[model samples]
Target: MPAQDHRAPPMPVVRLVVSDASHAYLDAVQRQIEQALLK
Candidate 1:
């Protein structure tokens, strides 16, 4: 219903910035997920 409502105002845009450490952690997690899927 909310999406169908044309009277609603536009939502604001969001930007995300991740640190180097966060990127490394995400890479490690992705590897873990891939290994689990292969098992």
Candidate 2:
């Protein structure tokens, strides 16, 4: 359960990929992921 919780955030990236997001969007996502990891 804990492992799946950790893996969950990346799932949204599929949508981002399909949408062809820009670098700024990716950078924001990266920052959120980094903050999550810091917690």
Candidate 3:
């Protein structure tokens, strides 16, 4: 019998809505992800 792969693939889009004060935090997270991919 073949085994199944339980891991799920990453999603293409991650949508989020935040207050003005939280926008900077969200932008920082997005930048981190982008930088990690560049390395």
Candidate 4:
């Protein structure tokens, strides 16, 4: 469970994939992910 929890956030970023995103939401999440990476 700990391992799965740790791996979960990246499943999106690693793929850079959003299953049902509109353009604006995708852009928003991308920026947030980049900020998290920077921190």
Best by TM-score: 1
Candidate 1: tens digits of C-alpha lDDT, residues 1-39: 867564344322111234556788999999999999999
lDDT of 3 by residue, 1-39 (tens): 123332222222222333544888889999999999999
**Per-model TM-score versus the true fold:** 0.54, 0.46, 0.47, 0.46
Off by over 4 Å in 3: 1-18
Per-residue accuracy of model 4 over 1-39 as CA lDDT, tens digit each: 999999898988755555545666888999999999999
Error of 4 at 22 (Å): 0.5
lDDT of 3 at 3: 30
| 1 versus 3: better lDDT goes to | 1
| Model 4, global lDDT | 0.81
Q: Could you give candidate 2's per-residue lDDT for residues 1-39 as a string of tens digits?
A: 999998998889877876676767888999999999999
Ranking by lDDT: 2, 4, 1, 3
Instruction: Give candidates' CA RMSD values in order.
Output: 9.6, 14.6, 13.1, 12.9
Estimate every model's Cα lDDT from 0 to 1.
Answer: 0.68, 0.87, 0.60, 0.81
Clashing pairs in 1: none
- The positional error of residue 8 in candidate 1, measured at the CA in angstroms, is 39
Question: What TM-score quantifies how close candidate 4 is to the native fold?
Answer: 0.46
What lDDT, from 0 to 1, does candidate 3 have? 0.60
